[model samples]
Target chain A: MLEWTRGQAVGEIDTPALILDIAAAERNIRAMADRLIHGSVRLRPHVKTHKCPLLAHKQMAAGAIGVTAAKLGEAEVMIRAGIPEVLVSTPIVGRTKIDRLLALSRHAIVLTVVDDVGAARAISDAATRVGQKIPVLVDVDVGQRRTGVLPGEPALALARQVATMPGLVLVGLQGYEGHLQHVQSRDEREAHWRASMEKLTDTADLIRGAGFPLDIVSTGGTGTSTFALEAPGITEIQPGSYVVMDDHYGTVQGVGFEQALFVLTTVVSRTRTTDVIVDAGMKALSSDSGPPRVRGIEGAQYVFAGDEHGRIEFADQGSNLRVGDRVLLVPSHCDTTINLHDHYHVIEDDRLVEVWPISARGRIR
Target chain B: MLEWTRGQAVGEIDTPALILDIAAAERNIRAMADRLIHGSVRLRPHVKTHKCPLLAHKQMAAGAIGVTAAKLGEAEVMIRAGIPEVLVSTPIVGRTKIDRLLALSRHAIVLTVVDDVGAARAISDAATRVGQKIPVLVDVDVGQRRTGVLPGEPALALARQVATMPGLVLVGLQGYEGHLQHVQSRDEREAHWRASMEKLTDTADLIRGAGFPLDIVSTGGTGTSTFALEAPGITEIQPGSYVVMDDHYGTVQGVGFEQALFVLTTVVSRTRTTDVIVDAGMKALSSDSGPPRVRGIEGAQYVFAGDEHGRIEFADQGSNLRVGDRVLLVPSHCDTTINLHDHYHVIEDDRLVEVWPISARGRIR
Candidate 1:
């Protein structure tokens, strides 16, 4: 019945380990590559999902234009791993952080986004110190009212500031409609993306009218990659979760991404019915997206036992599961769950294959 | 204002790091020690909260009988660091994991709990093979409905199974009432604790009357430590969050645990209207227990911008903030937030005084 690591040496694997299906991952990688080949959109997958430079290279080989990292530390890890193009999707601020970012830009084609003049000045000053012109993107508040300037005049002003800077290039405008990514209903998600795209396209027009040539209009995640790529003026889409689909992504219709990633947990207990506690919990997989789903186990609820244990109530009444049994749990949020571990086990056909180090697993800074 | 150092060095620490106010930590350590002093209750703070052996030593110095770890790796870290007594609070399953647990018991006084006969049998077999008798605590459901046997005949049956094993010692029971720990209402929490205590006390008596001499009866966390100590038959209270109170702990009444741990993040961007963005977000501090609260900023909503950025919307009237200003964010859940980092900074009076390595930072195994 056990499949993922069937004939392989499962001897040295520690409990609460993350196992990746190499075959499934390959299928997922090829699926995205096929999409990139057919579509005109530049595939700049966000590295924040896997955070493994090795996996980042897999995406680059599959024809991704660049990789996007949420933090400078993550970008540093990718750069060290020899990934060609990288973007610190988040803004670089403060003299110390700016200095670090400038140092990175000297070696790599690093790009960053900013919403205000204060942040723009910090990036400009850092670039000037390094004697280089840094590429900058003006973040527009399309619909996700978090960071970024308002879509019209404010976005234009920020883009103009970047264009006027002595050591900065206003490459494009970046805006993410995060709220629309996880809309459960297809009609609702499409409607939400349409509204968000209207704002983003309008902001792109505004920046272009402000005497700046916007080379890129970047946005979107795995949940709405298709919808985002089809947007009027968007040139690139940042879809991270497609690399490692989770339970939340499992709900998406026709996404074509396989459930390649799983937290391979050991059954620690089996008594009092078919109750089994797995080694993965809130610590191994994030509960922020709510509880995880048990793979291939219908009518079973994965209840969190503690910080490091999850109680999976089996579907079959009083199932004969015992201690030491390894079960797979689909993570709710692939990005956060992957960040919690130090390594990943690449499994094929229930066999222990290879272990990939999550080099940028906890590069939070 | 920050105060205290972990080791000896003193300098400006890199921003956006978890800092332990060592002095305040010492005081919290002493307070828990004093409360359990001259009493039957032994203090065994859960190491999952801090994950620092240095802080674990501080707990032991303040009269903690032992430390409780959520994983075997954490227990190994503490045992290797010279802490003699440790209990793997979570269940240990899998042959590889059981081997590690058996190996650990050779060096330290290792104990673990099991709510299932299958787990107890596995432990018995492992212990038998090692020619050692490992202590096992019968875990009771205790109203949390996470793990553990129901506190009636079910728990008695598990205890009997433990007693039947020559290689296993049925030392006592562990009933962690986790749901009571975060009961927002004081009366509700106390009332819930009373109900849970009655059930646990009844179960403890039932096991004792069944001719088993129970050595330890542990329950409680930071929120209900005082109330748990008041429980009729509980011999120890396992409180961990008090030493480093997160924003989640602030909801508990009379907790007396100051917000000692803060994510010292610098302002990445400042809008004209004084809206600010910080370097830390989901990767830095978890939003599972909800969004983080700004430590000293009044009337500011700390909205989560993305996985790597947090937006602080300051009241437009008090717009004195600028880029480079550092703000401390009280994490929603300290345990998960601390796990997301590799190292912590110990600060004193606006300067990074020392650095404390989170040695067991990613001990998922």
Candidate 2:
């Protein structure tokens, strides 16, 4: 789709390009797939990070059971790309969204999560009209407290309600501990992750005790997936960011992922003696956590000058950054940064060899 | 493009929708036009905020001399939509971008800004090869120091070099005071703006005193357009965010722009007694400046939970937000937030009647 930078050399590539180190990314994919392929659990990598079905297919080929999509639109993209099974990780609530959910059910085994009885009833009514039995999962509040029902009784009650509905099958429980994904210390992360996993498996037992076919207990992110693998009843782990690590995740202890993604920018303005301005800013690279770090440029600070310019202030006064020089910035947050671009310039051995479209990039609906 | 939410009701519109308040936007368009119609300094409203050709056409119809696009890709979008003139505000660097610049000069009057002589020569060589005379402005650094040459001799030297080039016309000088855009006090903002204008006008006079035809002096933004209009040598002002004001600009003192954009979200998870979760998060609404403000909820505070969720906590304990309730969030910055959506759900009389595709939404290359 993006035809401008297709056959250009690595030095001649345009600024503000989302460049992916394909070799490092494939190593990351193999590392996570290796961790989960031999365990009792499996990997259901989330599609929200890469938004590319080619990367998802590689994970599926390695040994992922299915792909986890955060929204119904993402699930549609994955299902249409011939991804057989997709778990809509978040709860789908609106009338138009639930209608879309039933439409997805007609094509593939689209499993979705629900935190409220009303949301479950809405999905059930829409699916019943279309003559389909959609698989459902009750989301339990496992200390993240952003979504999901309370662990023991309330989650069981919602599952009981879903069991009574006609066009739904009670499949599993999803309890995500997103709050523990960024803990700095490994001991502290494991301690907190065990507590969240205890509540998830406990709630799963309670639902199964109530005569429900609760098989899948899907949870965990890139930070907690390794620790969550040691837990009892988690059938799968959904770690999206491990395939393309950023500064936010690379700093955490015991996470073995390397930096695989970068925003390639060109130095457009270097008139200042103390700083040089690049063509990447809030519109090019996101600053949700903090400003992106300049790769291989030690002691260089990046501050967003405006929406389309980034100023890099080097610690040394004799920095030789000139106009048209290329610079790479490591994103602080990968998910939001990747959503800003339309494609990825796949790089290998410092050469831009291919361009891949981020197909479901802004599929927020 | 987006076909799912085309015929939906305003009440039942999908979550995480970019809704535009057309009435307030029209008033914003008229207010700036009325202030500049009888004055010498014209308006060239920046298109990076709305990124819509329809809105750009409205501004041109009112009184704007032309539109200011931040990138050449955006200029291609506007020129294809029949806009006669577009000033690419940022510098067009590198081989690929300059190639795009020459291609645009064949269609419309595409003006660009440059601060580096190496960059200007690159643009000139390409334009000379194509046999097209491109208009250019020397960017002068008033105070922001992000881009542009220093305001006195450095700018004059660059303009002298540009005048000697084969296929380039040295039009004017541009000095933008981006750092002073958010000064809280009106008197303080005016004082700093005047000091910056002195450098800009002094540089303009110095360049014009030479045998150069320095006709168009371009500068100013949404925050400093009023003060820049009062300066003598300022020929045209470029203010972008006045069309759809956000919470960041709404808190400033004398800016009379109202809120005209909102990210419509739905309460998908309301489990905790302290907080409820919506479907807008870092991916839906940007958090570069800060979190998006809750539009009408008086005491509610919003924090991004994950990629596709937002958690809102009310000051009062008895807030009656349940599941499936709609909420509106005013983006902290309009330009970056608008880049995340593909279309705008235009709102009129509380109805979602029209869906206009943001043809230039992600034109950052």
Candidate 3:
């Protein structure tokens, strides 16, 4: 357990703590729900960003149809949290992970994505051993060439193979435009998002024309959720970072989500007149995207001090920082930054309301 | 607990696991000890890289004067592990961390680094409340420009203030040249290392001449330990990454440490004929430095697939990869990569010998 308890002041919480603004988070959740209310697409918010069961429940309460997870561990956590519908967004290969995915079918409507025929066969074999039938989505490579098959014939062939395989159901197609999520220009992002959706919808038509059952066309992230909602065939949008927007996602033009997640740190060392050192660093906030933004501290730029400290450089010679002064930092990447901490110090205004455990933290397997 | 037991085969362990080659780790430990035996400088290995008490004990058993930690949480874990001397290398501010640090002093010889007089006074005041005197070292900025005072007058002023404050003992100076650790060229790194040591030694002399007691002059890392061992007035070297050399550290010239740490993963998805996706991604192996290198697999390049997958691209046209095949990955950055895992699957060749818990895995505060 953490040192600070509920009902404590925000300044009284320990340094280098993960802080969550409940008001802002709820606002963001409501905003996403309202945006997709009248559209054909429904929300299946990804739990990979927050990895908290409580947050997943909040998303579900706000009218999310289901939740999307990147790993089997996350799916298991969501299942235990009583989240009935979970789409395992990443492909589950190998005997161990496939067996775990098969076991998850007993508790929830578990759907996994697959790009390879060999992986499809593996899942079918594992499900056959467990006497269960698993629902699978054909992962299509729209633009990002990371982990998906090509859209037209390749996806159709894999769906056809999955249809023939016993103990498996070819449900839908998952085409994620990950590369277009962070484009600086809104017009460019919209253009790329529309093109990727076109590719995904065309491939869905191709698979359905081949006498395969394909209902859900899941896609989009926080950056492209609005565009995906208005698309022709994307039935579900999976946007994770909208709930707790970070500095990186906040920079995307016209994304009206408020920054809700922060790393509360203390100014530990202030030897130089130009810069002060905070207790948060790579261990407290991930720097894979870039350095986090110091929230509400005007003329301050956060720099990577080391693994355990952050250097905040001020524009003025005489700064407002002193030793032990608390500061909030908006992480650059929400998904990786949330993985670094154990608990989220949930705050309402200036008071700590609760400490929620990051249930799926360190669940790499 | 992990899925596999001791003495199990390497193939039986779960995917995306942190594996430690015991033989290679012991050899790396002995290599550092042998290199510093005849020198005036002793080894005070930093436990931030591995963060495992069992590995720290192995280093101390070989030859280590003390252990250096980056946080008070790590110090607490080290103290519980029966490590006699622990020096916290980062400045700890606030009442919560100070109270914990003071409590740790009752069990072991504890030391902390401070750059500002305010932080020095905070530690002194906390120690006074507990009726125990605490030893502190003046942290000098040598070149990192992160958390340290500007070497000569600033460091001397803090040391003098610490000398006047009751319940605080100014015993040493800590000057780390962190920027010179991975300069790529051996000559350039050596030049920077020598200059930083000269600055630290000169600052130590100035503080001692000003009637302040300064004995230990701690400096060095995996890249500059050899140069630090022969530098004049430098009493100890704090190199953490030598025990578990990563891909980034392995690229440095003349650092002959064997790679001991590996993230064991399985091939999960294969969409392209040239690329196969593994289960270890940024969450399994830290990709802040670069993508991890695939070990022993010739003509293979590792690419970041997503948060939970790594796409391994093969140079050869025909590959032998299939679902469930295990692959070893050398992490790009060892410190952050080690923090992402909870256990280290200790292996001796093809056999799993032991499972060591990462006792200080998420001790970031």
Candidate 4:
């Protein structure tokens, strides 16, 4: 549907369109690259935030070693688009998924995380039968307590089991502190960040002391990448949202990335003097964190009216907006909002230039 | 992806799949038809809950007059699928959308709602340019200050303006009491429902008294459908979410519809004795209302862990679950959850019978 938007002006495009500012996005990618170019830690930004392979290539060209994905289906999309090295950042379980993983391992170097022994043995058996050595990292739970083995003895135990398996290679440790990515204060964020990093590094040394290879200790995100640079042992970083920052990440104290993404909406109705309605609502924009801010419109507040409409109430002069007018808004959460649309309307020099399909938008399985 | 599941067993399907129970859904459709078959208010069930054209055809087969869509892109999908009548339940604004609406009116009897006189004029001018007479309805804001005009005088004023405009016919009024849809108490829901209905009917009479034909006064939803059946002067009810119930509707006392939809997920990690992680998370299930319920798994609470994983912790035996185990969950809100998937795996007698495309899942604009 968005393929025809190329060669058209920006304002002529349809409403409720996911827009990507090319210049700003390029600047953001370069900024992240410049942050890690001189460090010992290599870059492998997560692909979940921007589900586009073209953007992944941009990051790779800027200085990234590879890309990190959250699911097998997402990895498949990137690999099919010719991304060579991909690390699925989550554990891969079940029969069909394991079979798919083994099949995918034949095409590219695919590495996944593991926290349980039974699941690891299953993958080991499947890989041995297919004559493939799949690389794996021990997923250690520093503090989030969501998914991952506990640090110290527990993480080393999983690492030991992974190293002895015939068809698997234990290459590294993946300890991501997702819980500390959005801490409002820089001091509190770095304090928790250093604590989580200490646990991860101690576990990495413990596994290496037991005579296993733990070379690639990958971690970090947009809000804590600078802290990762300060840490000593992390060999790679996976900061995703810095490339297209949202309102949620912008509020963090030290995050200096410009907002490169927005939802272009249209004023559908102006019934009352103080209230107006737009075409973007909960279905168009995500609201898990909070409401979106009205960009380029002053003294206006946006609230979800329904699945298809958003209410924007103005404080003075009722925004001076009329029916069929356009408004831009920065979404609350970039990852979840990007997962809802099919493509991103690329804007360059205030003109519609390209439409890139979000190849892995609904790749939940 | 789901095409091969048409002849396979239900247990072998992939994780995070949206499922529709054929028997249970047919029973729900029949129950809703039986509820309003003897009354003057016919059914024009809203298709926003189930974006499937097959489900819309099933509703029509059960004696629904037409289908109500929330966007023009959705109405275009349903109309292209051979449904003869569609009523777009929201206001259609902007140039491209009005042109698309005029083009769609040539194929089906398309009716849209409008609250502002300027938008109505834009739609009328476009229809007249194409030599078409598009039906328009005055959307009345009964109590939900979302998208409609104010109830009494403002609604009548808009109706009068629409009556004299060329290429448009003033059909009726639509006042949906969305704020009272999920009221937990039946007495409170009915009290507010009756008051909203009185305002709508009074405005309908006022418009008709001014020599305008205000025949249709449509409103209702799954939460307050029985109360709408008791109210007078509501020509038809637009009760969606009845054919496939969710936990949001199940919490309401009097909405007695069977749960016909679920998301099938698999446990991806079981590191601890008390907690496990599933493949479904915020991307698989919508959490605007709340978290989804773990079906057929007792004493386990589901929390969104990330964009691609769910953390389910058990109270007693920790769900008696292992890695690669299957789990079923009822979504909190059906409409927003269905918009996340591409297709529905239809199960009849516990076997995958068909895979229907969600034709209008991303049809926001």
Candidate 1 ranges with C-alpha deviation above 4 Å? A1-14, A228-232, A314-320, B1-15, B184-188, B228-232, B270-275, B314-318
lDDT winner between candidates 1 and 3: 3
Candidate 2, residues A239-333, lDDT tens digits: the string is: 99999999999889988897999999999998878899999988888888789999888789998888899999999978999998998899999
The digit string of per-residue lDDT tens for model 2 on B278-328 reads: 999888888877899997788999988888999999998788998999999
> Model 2: clashing residue pairs?
none
Q: Tell me the TM-score of model 4.
A: 0.98
- Residue range with the least summed lDDT across 10 consecutive positions in model 4 chain B: B1-10
Residue A229: error of model 3 in Å?
A: 3.1
Docking class of 3: medium
Report the Cα interface RMSD of each model, rounded to 1 decimal: 2.9, 1.0, 1.4, 1.2
Between prediction 1 and prediction 2, which has the larger DockQ?
2
> What TM-scores result for chain A when each predicted structure is judged separately against the true chain A?
0.94, 0.97, 0.98, 0.98
In candidate 4, which residue ranges exceed 4 Å CA deviation? Answer: B2-9
Give one digit per residue, the lDDT tens place, for model 4 in A146-169.
778999999988888888899899
Please give, for residues A53-122, the per-residue lDDT of candidate 3 as tens digits: 9899999999999999988899899899899999999878666677777777887999988888877887
Q: Give the whole-model CA lDDT for all candidates, comma-separated.
A: 0.80, 0.88, 0.88, 0.89
> Candidate 1 clashing pairs?
A3-A350, A4-A349, A4-A350, A4-A351, A5-A350, A5-A351, A6-A350, A6-A351, B2-B349
Show where candidate 3 strays beyond 4 Å: none
Give lDDT for model 1: 0.80
Alpha-carbon shift of residue A10 in model 4 (angstroms) = 3.3
